[model samples]
Target: MRIAFIILLTLFYSCRGVSQSFEGAWKGDLAVPTGSLPLHFSLQKGDTWTGTMRSPSQTRLDFKLNVIEVAGDSIHLQSAALGMSYKGRISADGEHVEGTFRQGNYTAPLRLGRYDSTQTVKRPQEPVAPFPYNVKEVTFENTASEVTLAGTLTQPKAPGKYPALILVSGSGPQNRNSELEGHKPFEVLADYLTRQGVVVLRYDDRGVAQSTGNFLQSNIGDFSRDALAGLRFLKAQATVDSTRVGMIGHSEGGLISLLLAGQHAPDLKFIVSLAGPSLPIDSLMVLQLYHVGKSQGMSEKQLAKVRPINRKNFEVVKSDLPAPKAMTQLLENMKSVGGASGTLRKELQVMLLEPYRYFMRIDPVPFIQKINIPLYAAFGEKDVQVPAKENQESLVANLAGNPQSRIKTYANLNHLLQPAKTGGLQEYYTIETTIDPTLLKDIADWIKGL
Candidate 1:
């Protein structure tokens, strides 16, 4: 998921004064490689000009720009939580901002003009009203955490008890539909699968959308409990077959499904890992960063330099030594690569926090190897994050003796499983199709086989 996307910080800023023409709102499109991300910034000129940023494509509808510093006509706004920063100059007329938006190693051109109401993107794949199935908004409580998880449950209209499948969303705080860019793949998948006679339960991640919880404080075990709670809810329903309840997880959700299979093997009949990481997250992250960086046109030299730094950072988190000792080693490693700055140092500490630390240290292979339930895992050939070849190989090797496991990879598909020319994250929004038909068929066919 994105540690950068949801870093919340309470910064105290002194209102310098509302003396400039830069007051009010300015809105524009940040042209990323996949599609345009509509960004709305409301610059309130005060003692220290404050601003809030809104990206219609993102889950957080309104976000306080963690750091926005203005020096004369020069403007600098940053959201360290999102690994995003903007540096530009306000036009002489104070009606425009021309700048570059940077996230990690990715950068895109952004131009803002007079503030306009947030615009909506067309998502044809999103399931509309009058769904063919019986769709209802439901909520269930995770007894251990006492957190309410809200979700949509869709059962075939026939009313007979049917096989149930819980849809677990991937990284980041996603709504019921696992929405990203302009696509609602989970909704589309739910609609299709439900129509094919399966009950589908898709829900928002804890602390996301209608759910309640602190995502920052949650880790894999916390999420595993949520998935298990959803499974319990689905199994207890009269419309679902308790004996045939299964889970289909995408990306991180896939890993969660495996965890469920390992911990709640009796309750979970089967699982599907769609582009799920089979290796330790740290290993997967390096490959992901490299692929994404390469797609963004990062030169080989730059990649070579940064990749090692990132790998070392992960190693620091995974080291078995004492926490302070590990951190000292990490700083030394960072200095050797000229990356030991205050920001990077602080970022390293955040990485050691629960979420990042879990990803770095947790290895799913053992859980997967212990999984006794049937498992169906598939990967997109063109996927950059959690690439197909290596992940598939690991999964296959780990499940060597499990005949119930099915692993396959599809060509020309990106992480989202849409037929993509280039499997870059930037291409996510531009593609019209939510998920490729073949991917759907692969899942449906496997489920039918069970």
Candidate 2:
């Protein structure tokens, strides 16, 4: 599953040349019940006022402001796509912008000051170079998709023919490091595993930084082909033992691994799944919605009210109808159900996109039951995105015939395997730990043992 950031932006009052003063960078801390989220805004005065916003704690990419307007002493910024807006007034000294940030049902006070370079989030587990291993920048092609993927490959310095792993990222357009919330989990995983004498290759998703192809137009099957291309490239390397190469995937990546293994892809000896689903996609998403909503402090009554609507929406997407027809049916169902706000309608429209529609129809149990190779699956106990208990049970039941398969769940860990409290998406930015240390060791040990 992907974690999306809804970010807000702000401009400055145009009267008295205040807008010119705001043409530079500004920063702010948005206070929420979980913790503070750091946001940055960069405004530029061109033919027309233009600006971009970033939430450094959640994502590194800047979101372009869709609307920027100034009315008297007040300034407003809005992004219809992200469902976010900010309204604030410029201070007398033109040094501060006091505003309220709104995204969906969440709103909080925000006060922006001059950008400070020193204030940055710390990720202790992110690897730094000192040269114990040989790292290479590599590229490969998926002939089926006509995409060239780029990535980093790390290997032991004393590399002979050794066991190799291809790291597959979760959903969304991610770089080679699988970066999120200012943390690079894939880099750390590659570093630790390479240090343990394994060859690791992690790559950018198609159309993500340094890669070619349109990420938005791709689905899980297309990604699985891309991963197969990676496996083919790794097997061709002289330093890798062709029979000993395998895949290690996280979230959606994990599902991709399962797909390949079930299909009995060549040279893919084993697989590891991190928070991959074993149940049907529709059921899994419904559970995810319930758990995530509860973790965000929604009342049980409120959750109960939306549960049926969500089920109906998923059912519409899962149907075999054409895309346009399914979307029309979905809209009619929501209208009949009532209470769906304009914001929710927009979000539902996103579900009609090919990616979500394909995802909702997947039944991973069939794939899980088909796997005969050695497999290892891990889940975080506190992972609301892919809850452990139900998925674990489904996997165990489906993989019963595969005695070589192993499944584990770590306590107090969130979706990213960080030790967490509530395991809410907002808390992911606040937690300094990237991937839990114990889980990292466990993964390496399991792969090496195989």
TM-score to true structure, per model: 0.79, 0.80
Question: What does the lDDT come to for candidate 2?
Answer: 0.78
Candidate 1, residue 24: the lDDT equals 80
- Residue 224 in model 2: lDDT: 90
Report, for every candidate in turn, its global Cα lDDT versus the true structure. Answer: 0.75, 0.78
Candidate 1 displacement at residue 437 in angstroms: 1.8
Angstrom error at residue 34, model 2: 26
Per-residue lDDT of 251 in model 2: 89
Ten-residue stretch with the least lDDT total in model 1: 5-14
RMSD of 1: 7.5
Question: What is candidate 1's lDDT per residue for 195-221, written digit by digit as tens?
Answer: 888999998878766899976567777
